[model samples]
Target: MTATAGAPAPSSTGQGGGPADDAGKESADTGPISAISPADSPVSPVSPASPTAARPLPPALPQTPTPSPEGSRPSRNAPVRLRALDGLRLLAALMVAAYHYGGRGGEISQAWGSSPREQFPTASTYFAYGCLGVQIFFVISGFVICMSGWGRPLRSFFASRVSRLYPAYWAAILIVTAVFALPWVAFKSVSPSDTLVNLTMLQQPIGVDRVLGVCWTLWAELRFYALFALFVVLPGANRQRVILFCAVWTLGAALADAANQPFLELVLMPQYAPYFIGGMGLYLIHRYGHDALAWGIVGLSFLIGQHYAVAELWHAPNPSFFSYRSTLGIVAIVAFGYLAVALIALGKFHWANWRWLTLAGALTYPFYLVHEHLGWVVVEVLHQKLNIPSYGTFALTILLMLFLAWLLYRFVEQRLTPVIKRSLTAVRVR
Candidate 1:
């Protein structure tokens, strides 16, 4: 499907209504990311907006969107697909879940204790490598967000983003907080104020542990979103300007780390910025249409980084110094960024479209949110009651957590998302 200005082009295929005639009618333009209503339509054959005699230029499309930013833009000529991107998300989420489960059972520490001559591997050196998943998420978010906001007014872009992210997050926070309060109702002691800080998403600033341990990452993501919004709002801002800003931030983060300075932690966390910057860089590469080479590099880098770089750096006797592993981490970030760009350019990878995997990927966020706490409870119950082996107990706990998360996503998240979207859109309209 091809879109011109804010209008959709006439449909070439006879399957749908004529593009010219349909251009004048409003329909729902659903894609991977945010949906566009007729008024926000970009004037393409697939656009839901009514047709006019003169189509607007591509750069002058409507500002408001109908869909959320989590999806990609709608295509005017052909259907857009990005299965590889979903696969990437699934991989990242699984890594995080596995990391948590591995740590919970002391599996990683046990692996670390074993030697080459040991009978059984004690710990997996790759335990810390799981954090790289968050980096992948950052990269994907940066690229998709940049694309979503292209040629749109900054305020509208910000509004759309706030609508997409905040509602689900806030609802999650409330649910988690209520769970925390259940112990209080049973006469257990828990700090209400501390929980309140987490609900407000201010725990990180106050040096408090996230109410939901995994929420710290959400804080970082939000910070990047705010920064990107500012970049877009700034006059004459473009991809180059964004790149320059990211470069400066990366350098500052490195310098801060080198100096053991705490100041940069206030604005930019050194270890984290590389992931976000890597993502933004990937977006720039994709916008420029350099996707194929980017993917090859990303895949190669991910393999080498995970197998070699991570092992070397994480195992170093003195990891404080600039080392090969750190260099590889940087390389991995670049590679991951390229991979994301390539995935976007391809629109969809066939392998990622497997129904089971896609369903698993769709439940990822809820899984990430609920798995750890619920997993802990399951492990406790099994270890204390069933006396299962440590590994067996851990594995069972993960299974239970996954099951619970699936239920939560199916019953709660799935039901609430549409309502939240509608409510937010109504508010926006008001």
Candidate 2:
């Protein structure tokens, strides 16, 4: 049920595998003010999952300088980077990691030799809710994708995404596959054909199995990019057009849900659309300054998002069998996620502008990619074999995951992104 493969049913539930599970699974910009700066300009590279991008703002919309921990804001026309937002990405990644490491004991119970709840009764209860972190990531994607993709032709937008998403992802797929190949590792190996298909990140649509459980979200992200490129970027995205896109997407998703049309719901993403829509609304406010219209968009998204959040909890596999999730708690967690981003959009967390936070953000996508199954295997070796305490195993696994993330980013993503970008651009010219 969870995004992970071979994981126990109730113990693992968050992102779904393939199109059906990913359709509305938890997982977001604004407006027309002189083609606001694209987040993907040639400044510091931002992760595809990260919300902050650096580009000079359009001369039309100048921002007044404000005091903050990072010092006074740069002139409005200067490139904008929300370092705090980057840090938030790491937090979201960790929340999901916590869910797997501390919250669930299902498939992992084989290694733990007992239930995780028994091992960390107090912690499991809190970490169980971390699954909601997927929604937070989705919301942030909406904001960053909209910000980064603004003012670009469809080709340029696609190129930026390819460069950002594929570098780390490719590295992750090979790395995880190699680990799974080890004779000692218990996880099953993905077939060679499936591995090749996964490289395209289209395995879900074509009904091929995912190499990494967490990769299910990538399908959602890819759909979002395609839709945005076609509807928003191709026609020229601005405040009015984007707002219209949001409204239309919201309505279309609702209709799809009502009609019980699986294909429509898959495309429209009724469950997940609200968060993405709301994020775009927040970005509009961030870029163009707050207005009733943007606020209304966000409000509508929250209403719709809340409905799906609770519904996911209720409809979860055998809700009565091992139900530890509360509907109200789910709602509250989702609201907290929205509030955190809203504060960032409003520039209320200016104090979070630490430089190292950007590094933390950069690690998020790679961290999320490598964490789940790999971490589970590591936990098995550490606790089951080494006889380490549960908490100690958790701590060591997180540190190792972070190190792997850094390696993926520094050695793989950093080296490969520009290469991929150039390759794509070269092909385009021909």
- Maximum-lDDT candidate: 2
The TM-scores of all predictions, comma-separated, are 0.63, 0.84
Model 2 Cα lDDT, one tens digit per residue, 77-148: 334556666666667677778877776655556556677787787888787777677777667767766666
Give the local distance difference test score of model 1: 0.43
Q: Global lDDT of each model? A: 0.43, 0.65
Best by TM-score: 2
Residue 30 local lDDT, model 2? 9
Off by over 4 Å in 2: 1-75, 315-320, 426-430
Q: For candidate 1, what's the RMSD?
A: 13.8
- What TM-score does structure 1 among the candidates reach? 0.63
Candidate 1's residue-wise lDDT over 298-324, tens digit each?
A: 343344334422432343545342111
lDDT of 2: 0.65
